[model samples]
Target: MTLFSLVATHADLDLETVGILSSGAADVAGSVDVPAVTLATCNRLEIYAEASSDDPAALEASREELIDAVAETSGVDRDTIASTFRTLVEDDAVSHLFQVGAGLDSAVIGEREIAGQVRKSLADAQNAGTVSGHLTRLFETATRTAKDVGARTALGSRGRSIVSVSLDIAGDMRGDGAAFYRDACVVLIGTGAYAGTSLAQLQERGVRDIAVFSGSGRAEQFVAERGAAARALKMEELSEAFSAADVIIGCSGGNRQITAQEIRTLAGIGPEGREKDLTVIDLALSHDFTPEVADLPGVELITLESVKMAAPAETEDSLEQAREVVDAAVQEYLTERQQRSADDAIVALRRHTQSVLDAEMEKVRKQHGCTAAAEEVEFAVRRIVRKLLHTPTVRARELAAEGRTEDYVQALQDIFGLEVEPRERPEREQPAKRRRAEEFTPAELAQMAAHLQKVPDGGFCPHHRPGEFAVERLEVAQRLTQAQAS
Candidate 1:
């Protein structure tokens, strides 16, 4: 069965739409007799939002329509198509693609944040039951590959982030006095990886007073680990914390956690009745703070997009280096996958060919009896058939490896008369039932070997006898030389 994959970045499309599109593509592929198709998205936000799509009926209808189309065209049941599609998504190819793109194998990178995003996306898909075999395999493999790449490489060993970029931006914002000891109060909203990193950098900048907020239980430990004069608050106390802060940095997993109205409320109050020029940095893909938050009086909302724009040329260069590493890893993975696919096909082909040969030999032996002459004839026939089939079998495999398998497969089917032909109902009626063939015993095998020894030279067989077989010949020659020395 052939397998194909489609990968795209999740920029603006809703999560459910992505899932529906993937399901549709998989269904279409199955209709065309394609065994598997996997749809993978790189953006975490797009994957996460699929579960809460406003149109459930529309989504279900789309899925059913696709499945029905495939079932009608391919003559495969909806259940089988569904199961196979599910299986295909869970395959290794999907995982490798994710690992290669997520900076896990990057040369100079420490972005474990992408890993978290991937995990969350997969989890969402899984929870929604949208993760069929294909997607499940893809995500699992992607996660494992990412983990392996991370462990084996130095990709996640560095510290390059928005916090570092912000430090540089802070340098630009604060001028010469930025690096000096400052008693600034920094309020970090959402205690995720990005927030924690920013907090550490802020501490290094000598911002002694820090307030960290998170919905997760880890927020308290995250605050204590920084060793800054810090306090951890629940997500519910965000508005209260915003009023007493000198600078505000927001990062959260929720879709649009902070709004423009909240920023306005923070701006309206402060010591001496003067509004604070709050710098709000949002690292979440869906955006923690609204774009309108920037319009609030003396408040700045910096998103991932904005940070990317404000980043220096050096940061861009580093990102390029990381991309190169990921590309190399992807190339390596694809090469390995191709080789594995070829190997699996070859092994299965060999087994099928051997089974056919064995059945034919057994039938000939049973008809002709186990006499020496009869056995010789049977052995000769078997040898001749094997010799005749060898080149074609090898050629078919070579064609398969070269991506030209169809002609070779058709040729084999034609030669063997194995192609299924349509028959009339009257012709098919009262067809003789085929009986189960008996297996050969050890004694029968030994007798057949002895009978083969009596076959004439180049008479349905090239070799002289059973002993003349290459393996037997080698053993006999070795024994004769040993006997002569003794």
Candidate 2:
């Protein structure tokens, strides 16, 4: 199956529209016919799906299906959903996911949180039984690629995020930089992932007095579970909490917009009674605080928009390093996927050869009555067959990686009279074994990390050329064939 994705991110739509799209993202998978994974973050809502074919018309139909499902579920109009969501097909889809997992696509570039979110989206799809083998590999590779980028580049090492950027802006607004965090009485309105991240970041900056409020009444549970030495604010306690808080962070992922008037009324502050400076950070896609809150006396607001505008530009060296890693990863993933396309042809050719060997062995057994000589002949014949098949096997992979698997299959059909119908091996019986993340030793990883810094464009070292490597391998195989023939 060909992979495609319908992506509606903050880049395409306003954060509010993204939030609206994300609200019902969980249900979109149920409406689609194909194996699907829905990645619904605060600023992005994407459905990565496996379509039946890579044909443009077929992919367009698949896109329409996904769009209809999202429109129905999200209550976004069909036209808007169709126009807003970017449809990425096959290679483009794969590349986009890798970029996203590497945090290159984040609002706060190189933010560490998105990698985990991408992984979680895969897990969520698996849990819901909506994931396929293709999609599973896609996401797993994306995660692994992200880890590689994180390890090899300076991009993701700092664990940057909306929370961190917001805090930085808040600190600057407070005129004390990060030192202001230590003395700030922070009130966090959210118990979700962003809130948890925000809480961790706040504590990391030496903030001590913190309170969490969940609109869904999970504040107490969230506080207890997180092991934070902070209080959970009850609904009635919000007024007191807001009034006392020096910094208010909103990440509750709720729809109720906490308006300027609401904050004023809740905090018991009036037009003439504005007492202390307050920093309001609305990190939620569905903003918890209204935009007008920035108008309040002594109030400084940091919304996602503000963060996007104020977010520091990444150093070119770090960004270039990350992109190199991602590009290499994308090419590798595509080559592997392309090679897998030849599996059925390879299996067919091998089975055909095995049948020929079996028939010849049957004749030998009939003639020799299972003698030692018969066994010897069988062994020699099998060895010869393996040697003869080796080049075909290698060529199959090479052809497939070059997107010429159809030619390989046609050659087999013409030469061996083998008609191979493509078939998927059962998941349990799948042959390709991916190298696990843990397989690399620390020393090897360090070498790779160092190589990334030194390697120029195309992500290959001076010692290796991909084209030359493939040519050398094929030449070696040809020499082996010549030796066997001689």
Candidate 3:
């Protein structure tokens, strides 16, 4: 299977469109195709799909058809599609996408929430049987790379999110000189990550009356550790706690448990002369409190989405910087991918050569009527080929690592008289066919012009260019120039 990576964002299409595109790619492959496309932002989606074929030409054709099909189906411009994909497969962009998607690039950097999201997406693809061997490796590599980058870099040192910001805002809401711990009662409903964080923030803000309620004893130890009042209550005590609490932070995974009736009941129980003002913070995927609670005489409801907006601008900038880190990582990943691709090609070429050598030796053995010596000849041939190819293979890998894979690959093909189908070429062509003088450096342009002067139509020389060295020489020179310049 040939792997192709694409980058897109969530806003580009609805869930239905995503489904259709995934299903369509799968149909083309005659199997469930897993898209390793990750959502880096509201505007970005990265897709890595694989096409199967033993023949490189057929594979290339199939890939093109798939690209065209996706563009048509999504009603997006082809250039946009290509550009998005280039970012994914290209060295810089791929690394960034992986990092960002992994949540390592989050504003509250290294929050661990992004890792879960990435895992979930991968799980969804796996469950659907869309993840094949190629995609599996790609995703696993990306995940590993993200983990490594996160560990190696200081990007996650001070990552904070809207939750952290909310705590700051909450502290400000309680006026200065009024000790939070002495003045107001803070009730944290639910024992989720966000709730725990909010509770911690409240404590940090000097909130004296901190109460934590969970359906089980899970949070009791945590609350005790924080030296806060804790109670394990059944679902029924929600209204009583709501009535008694001044600030309520709700972060749960279940359905909307705080109903309108519950809010009304809480409001009704408050002192008639001086009504209670309840602040409800809902930080769950499915809201923990009903919107109708906002209409309560003295109740204020804050959804997760709203709180995210209220987060400090600096927090956003931090997240943006984290994203930049991710982008750098993606570029590194792309370079690795290029090297890997070159390695795969070399491996394939070696295998093919070995097969031919084995066949020829076997034929010679049969002709000599010496079956006993067949194994010896086979071993001898294998050693010879390995020795002969070792330097070139090693050089190819080195070039790939140095971002000079094209030269080594071209040289290998030329030397072996190997016909690399179009799909095997790593370079993508530009739409406008600009002249060499405009595109290449003066030296490169002169070299090309010189070489063309020797050919009938400014094409390659068949004899001299037939061997690997010819291609290698040009590529190495180009790479050296680039490296020196850099």
Highest TM-score, which number? Answer: 2
Off by more than 4 A, model 3: 1-93, 99-112, 115-155, 176-178, 181-184, 189-193, 199-229, 253-257, 267-274, 315-327, 369-380, 387-395, 402-486
Candidate 1 lDDT over residue span 24-69, tens digit each: 3323433432222323321221121111112455434444454555
TM-score for candidate 1, residues paired by index: 0.53
Please estimate how well model 3 matches the true structure, expressed as its whole-model Cα lDDT: 0.57
Can you rank all candidates by TM-score, best first?
2, 3, 1
| TM-scores, each model vs. reference | 0.53, 0.79, 0.57
lDDT against the true structure, per candidate, is 0.51, 0.84, 0.57
- lDDT score, residue 305, model 2? 85
Candidate that beats the other on lDDT, 1 or 2, i.e. the better one? 2
Candidate whose lDDT is highest: 2
* C-alpha RMSD (angstroms) for model 2: 15.1
Q: What is the C-alpha RMSD of each candidate to the true structure, in Å?
A: 17.3, 15.1, 21.7
Assess the local accuracy of residue 400 in candidate 3 as a C-alpha lDDT between 0 and 100: 77
